[model samples]
Target chain A: MRRLPVYLVLDVSGSMQGEPIEAVRQGVQLLISTLRKDPYALETAALSVILFDAKARQAVPLTELMAFQAPKIEAGSTTSLGAALELTKTCIEREVQKTTADAKGDWKPLVFIMTDGHPTDDWRRGLDVFRQAKTGLVIACGAGPDADTTVLKTITEAVVSLDTADSSTIGAFFKWVSASISTSSKKVDLTKADSSEINELPPPPPQINLVT
Target chain B: MTDQDSAQNALPRPVERAWTQLLEALRQAGVPSAEEGAYGFGGLPPEVRRVLTFIDRRWPGAYAASDSATKIEETDMPPAPADPPIVATEQPAVDAAEVTPDAAEGMSMAVSKQTILLKNARIDQPYQETIALEGVDELELIDDADTGLALDPEQDAAILKGLPRHSGDFLLRLRGWRADRPCEISAHLAVIPDPKSLWVSKESDREDPFWKPDAVFQRVEGELLCIGASKRGRAHAKDGLFRDDHVGVSVDAASGWHIAAVADGAGSARFSRRGSQIAVDSVIEHLPARLQTHVSPHLDALVAAYLSQAPDAEARLKGQLYRALAAAAFDAAKAIEAEAAAHDQTAAAFSTTLVVGVARKLEDGWFFAAFSVGDGGAAVFDLDAESLTTLSLPDSGEFAGQTRFLHKSEFVDYEAVAKRIFFAVRPSFTAMILMTDGITDAKFPTETLFAQHAQWFAFWRDDLAQAVEFSRANADLQAQLLAWLDFWSPGNHDDRTLAVLVP
Candidate 1:
C-alpha cells in the first residue's frame, strides 16, 4: 500500500505558555478530528508528531488516522527547532518506506513545521540534513509577530505566517492544514503524481498568509 | 411509618400538624436537618418556605394530622406563586419535579425525555432540533465551533444554518432559566459520514494533448458473447484524469474465432493511456486475421492430434497457437514503441500490461490460448470440469505494488515469449475472463485466494453474477458490465478494465 506520511514538527518553548500553547493543543485536536472524517485521508494518510523544547522527541510515530491518538502537549523551556528538524529527519528515515526491486514504497512524506519564536540552536545543520532526505512539501508556519518568516523561508519555499497564535487564528491554520492534506492525498491517488510545491495545495485561510 | 406515625400522634395536634407540614416540605425541597426550634424554622431559605406555603394551599390538610387543619384558608396565602410557574400537575407521572431529584426548591426546570436532540445526522446536511424543557421561559444554546450550529431563539430551536463541516458526536450545551435560577442540560448530537464526499467527478479536458474518454464499453455477439468495459477509477475521476485502461474485443461468426484484449496503462507514465489503447487495438487488428489464415484449415487435424494423445501431433498444434498469441503480443509491444518514438517520448512512457485470450470451437471442445505481460490475470472457468485453468503467468515482483509491463525486452527472446503463452481445452465452460489489476486486486486480493477454486466460485456467484445480469443480451449486457466496474474497494482505486467471453 502507498501511504501518505505526514510529520508535524512543533515548538513547545516557554514563550508559547499561555493561550498560544492552548490554541496549539486545540489546533492539533482539530486537525485529527477533521482528517478522520475524510475517507481518502483516513485510508492513505498517516500522522506522526515531533515536539521540541529543551529537547526533541517523537511524541507519536506514523500511525493510521483511525488508530491515532492525539498526544498531550505542554510548553517547556527553550526553542530547539534545530533538534526537532533533525529528529524529524531521523524519524522519516526510520518510518517512511522506500521503493526497491521487490516493492513500491509510500508517497513522499509531507513535513509541517510550526514555531512561535526563533530557534535557540543552530538550525542550519538540521536544515542541511533535512534537505538530503526525500520529502514532498515542507510547509513552515510562523505563528504570531515573534515568528520570523525570513528564517522560515530558508527552510522551504512553502511558508505561511499566522497573524496571531490565538485560538481562532491557530485553529484556522490547522483547518487549512487538513484541507491541504486532503488535497495532496487526493492528488497522488488520482494522478499518481506527487505534490512537490505550494501551488498544488488549497489556498490558505485568512489568518494564514502565504509567504513568497 | 408505623412507629413514627404513632410517636408523632403523642404531640399536640396544632404543633404536630405544623411540624409535619414543615418536615414534609423540607424533605421534598431536599433541605437536610431542620430542627424544631425557632432558629431552625427561621433558617429555611425563602424559596423553600414559599414552596411549603404553596403546597399547603394546593393540597390543604393533605399533610395535616387532623381534618381541622384545613382552616388555614386560601385568603391568608400570598397572592399566587407566579414567578417560577412550577405547575405541579395533578398527575404525578408527568410531574417535572418528581422526574428530577435536584429540582432546587420550587424550580421545576427539568429536561424532557428527549435527551438526544439529533441521531446520526449526516455531514453537509441541514439539521434542526427543538428541545423540550419544563418551566423554562428562555433558552440559550452555547455555540460549538466545530458543529457550525447557531441558537435560533425565535424558532426556539438549535438550527444548523449552514452545512455541517465535521462528523462526530457533539454535545449541545443548553442553558434554560426558571425565573432567576439557571438550569443547564446537555443533549447528544451524532453526525454520520457522507460517503459520497469521498468521490468527486471532474470533467476531463478534451483540449489536452493526450485525451481519451473517461469510460468505454464494447459488445459483439457472434459465435460468442464478448462484452468488455473500461472505466476511469474514482481517484482518476476526482482529478479529471483520463482513463488509463482500455479493452478491445472481436468475435467472428464465419471463422468461429473470438479474441479479447484488456490492457492497463502504467499510472506514472504520461502517455500510458495511449499505450494501452494502441496495445489492445494492435491485437484486435493483427491476431484475429493470423488465426483465421493459419489455424482455421488445421482445426480438424489439431483436435484429432489432441484426442489421440500423439506427442508429435499435439506439439505441432500447441506450437501453432503459442506462436499466434506471442506474435500478436510482440506486435503490440512494437506498435507502442513506434508510437512513443513518433511523439518524441521514451518507450517506457508508453508502458502497459496486456492480457489476450483467443478461442476456437472444435469437435471435442473449445481450444483456449492466451499471452500475457504484466500483473493482470486471464483464466478459463470450466463449471462442468470443476476446474479453473489460469492461462497466463503474472509478472508481479516478489512483494506487492510492483508489476512488469509490456516492453521490447519482454518479447525479445522467442523462448521467453513462448513461456508466457498457455493453452487449454474444455468441452463446456462458464466464461473466459480477462481483467486489469484494478479488478483483479479488488476481487482476488491475495495470490492464495486467487489460485483457489472456491474463491473463484464465490466471486462469480456472489459478486459478479449478482452485479451483472449475463442473461441480458447486447447493449444491456454492456451497460451492466460498465456499471459493475464502479464497485468500491478500500485502498484499491485505479483504472479498471474487464473482458468477459461467455458461450
Candidate 2:
C-alpha cells in the first residue's frame, strides 16, 4: 500500500505562548479527529510532527492515523525556522518509504508548516537544503500578523496567512489541512498522481488567506 | 550533475562575506582562539558547516587551519586577512570542575518538558535523564492517579514503570533533594491510545434516517450455485456508517438463467446506499424478467441456430441479450435519479457503480452477458481452457479517485449502452465472478493485472479457494463467503461486494 505521508511543521516560539500554543495543541487534536472520520485519509495518510523553537525536534515520527499520538507541545524560546526546515528535510529522507523494484513506496509527502513569527536563525540556508529534497506539496502558513509571509515565500510557493493565531482560526486551518489530506489521499490513488500546488487543495476557510 | 551540486554551486556570495566579517569581528575580540579550535567545527550546525566547507573549498584550507592547529605554518598562508585560526563556539564553555552537586543549586535536569507515551506500553525509562547524588536521596514521582507512571524512588528519574491504562495529557510532579536542598518540579506527559484498541466496531443505528445494514449475505443452490455477500468496510464500522455496497443474486428455474449484480455506492455521496441497493435490486428484478419475456419464447430456435453456427441467429441472440442487460441498467439508473429528484437532491448524491452478469447453459456452451458502469469488474473463468473473459470495462474519470457512475446520461446513447453490454460463450466455465471495486482494487490492483489470466487463476487458487469452500453446498456457505469478503487489505478498506456463480 502506498501511504500518503503528511508532515506538520509547527512553531512553538516564545510569542506563541499561552492561548496560541494551547490552540495549536487543540488544533492537532481536531485535525486527528477530522481525519480519522475520513475513510480515505484513514486508509492512506500517515502523520508526523516537527516542532521548532530554540531548536527543532520531531515530537512525533511518521505514524499512521490509527496509531498517531498527538504530542504535548510547549512554547520555547526563539523561532528557529532554519532548524525546523532542516529537520523536516532530514525526517522526510529518513522516514518516508521509497519505491523499490518489487514494491510501491509512499506518495510524495505533503508538508504543512505553521509559524507565527519571523525566523530568528539563518533560514535561507535551510530553505536551500529543503529545495534539494523531493516533496509533493509544501504549504507554509503564517499564523499571525507577526509571521513573515515573505520569508515563507522563499520556502514554498504555496503560502497562506491568518490574521491571528487564535483557537478558532487555528482550528479552521487544521480543518482545511484535514480536508487537503483527504483530497490528496483520494486523488493520488485515483489518478496515480501527486499534488504540488495550493489550488489543488480545497479553498481555505475565511480565517485563512492564501499568500500569492 | 545532480540538483544538489548545482544548488551548492549557487550558494550566495553574501553568506561567505558574512562568515568572513563575523570571523574578523571574533578575532578582534578573541582571547587566544586557536588553542581551543582543535575539534575542526565537527559539532556545528549544517549552516555553519556549509559555510566552512564553502570557504575551505574556495581558499584551500586558509580558514580551516583549525583542522590541524598543531602543524600551523604561518609562512605558507596568505597575509591580507592575517589572523590565527579561530574556533566557532556553539555555546559558552562550562567549567566542570567548578560545578559540583553540592555547589550547583536550583538547576533543573535536562528532562523533557512534555513527554508522550503510548497507553499500555511498559517503559523502563521513558526518558534518559538522571539526577546524580550521593545515592542516599533520589528524585521521587509524587504518584498521581492522572499519571499512569510508577517511578523508582531509589533511582533519580532513572526508571518509570507501569502500563498506562488511560490515554490523555497528565501532569507529573516530582520532589527530591538536590545538593541537600528540597526542590519541587512538575512536568507534563501525554499517553496515547493504542491504534489497535481504537478500532471499535459500532453497529449502525436502525433508527437513523439513512440507515443500512452492516452486512448482507445471500446464497442460491441449483443448476447455477450462486453466493454473494456485501459487508461494510472496517472504516465504516469504526464510524458507524452504513454499508454502501449491495449485492443481488437470482436463479430463474424456468429460463435457466442465473443473474448476479454487485453495486458499490460512491463514498462521497450522501445517499449512495440507496443508490447501490436500487442498482442491484433492479438488475436482479428487471434483467431476468426482461430475458424471460423477450428471449424465452425464441430460446430453443436461437440455441439450435447458434449450435449450427448460424451467423444471423447468433447476431439476433446477441442483440436481444444486449437489449435486456442494457434495459436493466437503464432502469437502475433512472430509478436512482427518480429517488434523488424526489428528495430534492442531485443525481450525484446517489452516485453508484453497477456491474451485473446473466449466465445460462446452452447447447453450444454457457452463455454470459454483462453490463458495467464504473470501476468494478466482471469475468468468466474457464479452468479447462485456461482462459478468462473480462466482461466489463472500467470507467475511470479525469480527476483522481473519480469513477463514472450509473446515471441517466450513462445510458443516453444506444450504441454506447450496447458497447457496455458484453457477451461471451465458454465451453465449460468454472465460475463467473462479479465484484465491486473493494474486491477488485485489493485483489487485482492494476488494469494490467486485472486483465491477466495468471492473476485471475491466482485469485481463485490463493485468495478465493483458501477462504471459501464452494464444493460444500452446506448452510454455512453464506457465512464462509461473508468471511472471505473480510480479507484484510491495507488501504483498500472500502465496502466489498462479491457475487460468484458456479455451473
Candidate 3:
C-alpha cells in the first residue's frame, strides 16, 4: 500500500514561547487524535514533525499514524527557516520511499510549513534546492504580523497568513490542516492521473487569509 | 566507426566522464538513460540539463531533446518488449507452452521456483500444465507432501537449482481428489515474484485480516476452567480490518490439564493474521501431546529429586520441561514457515509473537508452566494471597517498539530462548491470564504501571467470576469478555487478545 507522507514544519522560536507554543502542541495532538479516528488517514497517512529555531530538528521521523506520537516542542532561539527547509528536504530524501520500476513506493508527500516570524538565515538557497526536487503540495502559513509573506511566497505558491497567533486562531488553523489531510488521504491515489496535487481544500477560517 | 568510438571522438575526456557519471546517477534513481530511450529533460534540474545539453552538442542523438517530449510520455511508457503469450496445445486437460531460448535463460537467471496458489482450489485438487524446453534434462515438482498433489517425488527440494538453460517446456501434471466434494474447480494462479513484497491482493481485502471472531464460552465443571477472547482494536475497527491476534484453549480432562495459548501477529506483516492463527492452533494442538510424551513419564522421579535439592536432577527436570516447551514452540514456528512455503512467501510474512501455558490441578493447588517468545504479559492471580505474580515478563528488544517474533531466528534458537521459559508450582491461585501486548500496553503503559496495576487483573477476575457464576445460575455468558477487551486507550490501539483460566 502507498503511504501518504505528511510533514509538519513548525517554528519553535523564542517568540512562540507562551500560549502560541502551547496552542501548537495542542493543535498537533488534536490533529493526530482526529486523524487516528478516520479510517483513510489511519491506514494511509504517515506523519513527521520538524521544529525550527536556531537549528532544525526532526522531532519525529515519518511513522504510520497508528504508531505516531506527538513530540514535545520546546521554545528555542532564532528562527532559521533555511535550516528547517534543508532538514525537510533531507528527511524526505532519506525517509520517503521513491517509486521504482518493480514496485510502487509512498505517495507524494504533503508539506505544511507554519511559522510566526521571518527567516534569520538564508532561506532562498534551501527553497531553490527543495524546488529542484520533485515534491507534492507545499502550503506555507505565515502566522502573526511579524511573519514575512514574501519570503514564504518564494518557497511555495500556496501561501497563507494568519492575522493573530491566539489559541483560537491556531486551533482553527490546525482544524483546517486536519480536514485537508483527511481529504487528501482519501483522494490521493498514486495510480491515477492528477491525483497527486491537492485540488480542493477546506477554506481557512476568517483569521487566516490567502497570501495573494 | 562503432557508437562507443564515435562518442569518444565527439566529446572531450572530462566532459564525457561527467556525462557518463550523470547518466549513471539518473539510472540509479530509476530514470532510464537518454541513449537507451526517450527521456524528459524538461523536468530535470538546471544543472543536470546543462550537463546533458553539453553532451548533446558534442554528440548529437546521444540524448533526447528536452523540448521534444513531455514528462508523462517519458515516465509512463510501457516496457520496450512485451511479455510473451502462453501458447496452449490441443490437449484439453493439460496446457503446453514452448519456452523460447531467451525466455528460458531469463527464467533460469532471474526467476526462482515459486509456489503459485490456485485460488478456490483445495490441496487435494489436481491442476495440469506443461512447459516445453529445448536445452538440458527432466523437470520436477519439489513441494511439501501435505500439498496432496501427486508429483514424481514426495521429498521436498529446490526444483530450479542446477538445471541447465533448457529450451523445452517441462510437463507438470497435478492429480488429486477434491478435499470437500467432487466439483469443477476454477481458480487463478497467484505468484509472488519477490519474497519481500507485501502486496496483498484486492480479494484479500474482502475479509478484514484483524477481525476477531466472538468468544466461544466452554463451561467445564472442574477445579480449573479456561476462557479465551479476542477483540479487534479501535484502530482496526476504524480501518474496517480484523484483529491480528488469535487465542486457542484446550482441555485434557483425563490428564487434568487446561492449556491456553495466544499469538499476536506482527502488525506490519501482510499475512500475519493467518500466521497468528496458525501459531495458536499449532501450540494448542501440539503442546499437550508433547508434554505428555516428554515430561509426564519422568515427572515422579524428577519431582522427588528436585525436592531432595539435587542440582543434577533439578537441572535435568528443568532441561526436560524446557525441551518439551521449546519443541512445541518450534512446531508452531515450523507450521508458520510451512504455511509461508506453501504460499511461496517468506517466514517474515507470517511473523507473530507466541505465549502458551498449561495449568494442572494439583493436590496442593495448581502447577503452571508457560513459555513466551515475545512481548506480552502472562500473570497468575493468587487467590489465597490476593496478589498477582507475573509468569513470563515481556521480552522487548533494544528498541521500544521492537520485540522478537516466534518465527524469528532468535526465538527458534533454543539455547538462547530456553532460560526465558517460565514455570511455577503455586499452592493456590484464583486464575491465570495470558494476553497480547495490546491489552498490557493500554492498561499498563510502563513497567512501573505494570508493577502497580494489580487492580487491572482483579477487575477482570471479579467480572469474569461473576459472569461465570451467573452463567452457572442462568444461561452461558454471552461474549462479555470481548466488549471488556475493547476498552480504549489513546495512541496505543492494537488488536487485543486475552485468555484466562479460573477455578
Q: DockQ: which candidate is best?
A: 1
Worst 10 residues of 1 chain B by lDDT: B85-94
Clashing residue pairs in candidate 2 are A190-B401
Model 1, B338: alpha-carbon shift in Å? Answer: 3.1
User: Candidate 1, TM-score vs. the true structure?
Assistant: 0.61
Expressed as tens digits, the lDDT of each residue in B1-503 for candidate 1 is 65644543353333233445545555676655434222332345444444445444334444443434223344434333132222221122223123333322223333232333443356788866555566554454543446876555356443334466787767766555443344555665656566556677987889987798988888887767888889998878877888889998898777888999999999879899999999999999999777877678886787777778877875676578666777788889999999999999988999998999988787867888888998888888876677998877866755335677888888677777777888777888888899988888677755666677777888888888778877535446767777889997766678899888888
Interface RMSD (Å), each candidate?
6.8, 5.3, 19.5
Local lDDT at A169 for model 1: 93
Write down the DockQ of candidate 2: 0.12
Query: Per-residue CA lDDT of candidate 2, range A1-212, in tens?
Result: 88899999999999999989999998898788677656567668999999999999999999987668788899999999998999999999998988764355788999999999999999998888887777999999999889999999988899999999898898889889989998897666444467877898999999999997
Judge candidate 1 at residue A182 and give its lDDT.
88
Q: TM-score per candidate, in order?
A: 0.61, 0.65, 0.47
Off by over 4 Å in 2: A11-43, A49-108, A117-138, A150-159, A165-212, B1-164, B168-212, B238-240, B289-321, B342-344, B382-387, B412-419, B452-458
Tens-digit lDDT string for candidate 3 (B401-440)? 5688887475545567766676666678777888888777
Each prediction's whole-model lDDT (CA): 0.75, 0.75, 0.65
Q: Using lDDT as the measure, what is the rank order of every candidate, best first?
A: 1, 2, 3
Error of 2 at B287 (Å): 1.6
